[model samples]
Structure formats: structure tokens, C-alpha cells
Target: MDWDRHNRHIYNKVIDSFAVIGKELASPVVLAENTYSVDEAGILSSVLNSLKVLAGRHELKTHRGACVERTLITSIECISADSRHLKPLIIWPATTHRSTWTTHPTRGWHYGHCGSGYTDTMISLHWI
Candidate 1:
């Protein structure tokens, strides 16, 4: 809750300290990852929605997404007559699962129970 107040000349010491600690926590061994650019991120966004289209739904049961390395699909919800919302719930990419997709509670293969795996991993299940 601490933040620098009214002193533009002085650096944000608290934040700077944390920045160094953060770098140390994730050294070269941990800092490695597959990098991506904005365009690639856009494509990932498209990929998830594309999957939703294949599932035959425009409005998802709720927002859901998954990511691995540089390929991240952040959750997005458009409401309030095309309002925009974006939030990343899962930043810690999984190691075992390569492709991340969502399965709605209603669209579950068994109509409710079949989505446990997707729902559990994506954290986007609703109205089962």
C-alpha cells in the first residue's frame, strides 16, 4: 500500500527496491521464456474465440483462457453494449498442457459434468 508522494526528483525507493528483488528472484535461469509481440497476442486472442465458434457459441458461459510460454489467451468479455474488459487470471503457464481451450458448463459433452477438466483449468465455468 506504500507509494511515493509528491517528490518527482526522488526515485520511488520502495518500488525500486522491489524491482531489484524481483530481478534477482527470476535470474537468467528463470527469466527465460518464449517471447511474443502485440500482433501475436492478437492472434492468440483470435484462436480462443475461434475455438468458441467451433463450439457454436458467441457469448461464452463466462470468460475463460489459458496460456503456455509466450502464447497467452487472456480472458476478455464484451458487455454493456460492446464494452471492453480484459484481465489475466492465470499468468503462471502450465508445463504439461500445451494447448489451452475452454468448455462451457452448458456445452459440456455430458451437458454439465464433461467440462470439469476444461472448467477446472480455465476457471470459467458457469450455469452448469
Candidate 2:
């Protein structure tokens, strides 16, 4: 095996290109009217995670959330010791069949895996 600088550069370039393409790939947007100010890191991570799920043809799932006052339960939240802040709204389809609310040990909020019959479609949590 040869570890050449050219090979490393090419690998890095491919990864960088993938990241750019992933960002362009849209997700099941939940909130469009709502407002959110996410830093660069958050945006990058969100895009990367979304691409991980949307890379190939995925099965559908259920979509759920409580919408109140133009605010919906965000998919991602950044919390500290005492202050919990919501992250930017994102849209990513559930690859499994368990979208309905499930009981988790730590976080009590999950919106994925809703059973079969979910095809190519976008599911987004929103408020009226």
C-alpha cells in the first residue's frame, strides 16, 4: 500500500465534494415560516446527518409533533445545564418503521419509525 500525498489530496477532495453535494440535497423540511439562527457548525452537521439518511432510497415512516404558536417540536435541540435552546428546523425522512412516539430512557422526544407503507415522501413537524 502506498500512502502518497496525491492520494491523500484526492481522498480529501472527494470528501469535500460529497459534503457540498449533501448540503444541496433537500430533506423533509418541517418548519419554513419559523425563524432559526444556526451557526456554521450546526448547519454543517445537520446537512451531513441528513445526507447519511437520504443517500439511498429509504422506506417511509410516520410523522408527529405538537404544533403551537407557530412553533413545532424541533428535531434537534441544544441544551445546557439549565438553559435548553432549540436548533434550526430540519427535514429528514425516517428510514425505519417507528415514527410514532416511543419511550426512551433519556430523551422523551422522538419522531421516527412508524411502520411500513412509507414510501418516497417528506414528513415535517409543524405548527399552525
Candidate 3:
């Protein structure tokens, strides 16, 4: 493969131009205080497969068939370069909120629900 041809210098130039413009507009400290990095992660409540197990000779069949139900939970976190962070937004896989889920609530964290346990456009807008 021709590395130089595939590397796309135009895209790099565009990014470098943006960097220059950003540096001209704001100082490092001001940028750090105002800019935030956001990220999202998904968690599975249960795994269907187990790596290690101990079973009786007669119970192997039953053990193989056993599996736990899983729920998909999504969490969105935001932080700034100044070492400050906002409370995470948690997304559950339900159409409506469940009170039992938050028996002990987190003080400032936010929660939302959707049919699929993932962040959609509306959820992202609300978070923003």
C-alpha cells in the first residue's frame, strides 16, 4: 500500500488550520475552562455466558441451559481539561421511569429512558 497517498494530507491540513484558529481565539487556560469532553459507555446488567463453573456430573445439562436476563444501561459523562466534571447522565432501557431503580438517588446525576437503552438525538439534546 502507498501510505502517503492513502494518508489524506488535505484532512490533516484542515485540522491544522482549525488548531491555528483556536489558538488565536483563546488562551490555553480559557480553553481548558470552557471546553468539555463528553463520552458514553454501555453496561450490561448480566452476562449470558460464564467462563468458569463447577457442576456435578448429572447437573451439567441444567447448568448449560441456565442464563441470567440482561438489561442494557448507558452512561454519558462530561469533563473538562481543568479537572472539573459534571454528573453523568444514565439511560435505561424502558419507556418510563422506574422509581425502584433509584431507591437511593445520586444527588445531581440525571436519568432518562428510551425503548432501546442507547442515547438518541433527543436524549443528547436534553443532555446538552
The estimated TM-scores of all candidates read 0.17, 0.20, 0.61
Top candidate, metric lDDT: 3
Error of 2 at 26 (Å): 22
**Least lDDT summed over 10 consecutive residues: which range in candidate 3?**
1-10
lDDT of 1: 0.34
lDDT of 3 by residue, 19-126 (tens): 996886587456667777799999988666656467876666667645567899999999986889978999999999999888888999999999999999998888
Index of the highest-TM-score prediction: 3
Superposed model 2: Cα runs more than 4 Å off: 1-10, 13-15, 18-103, 116-122, 126-128
lDDT score for residue 19 of model 2: 93
Q: In terms of TM-score, which candidate is stronger, 1 or 3?
A: 3
What does candidate 1's lDDT look like per residue over 1-128, in tens digits? 12234365346776798798677656665432322111111224233432333332433434334522234333323222123322222221343433333433222222112212222433433421
Q: Least accurate stretch of 10 residues (summed lDDT) in model 1? A: 34-43
Clashes of each: 0, 11, 0
Candidate 3 regions off by >4 Å?
1-30, 47-66
When sorted by TM-score, best at the front, the candidate numbers are: 3, 2, 1
TM-score of 3: 0.61
Worst 10 residues of 2 by lDDT: 40-49
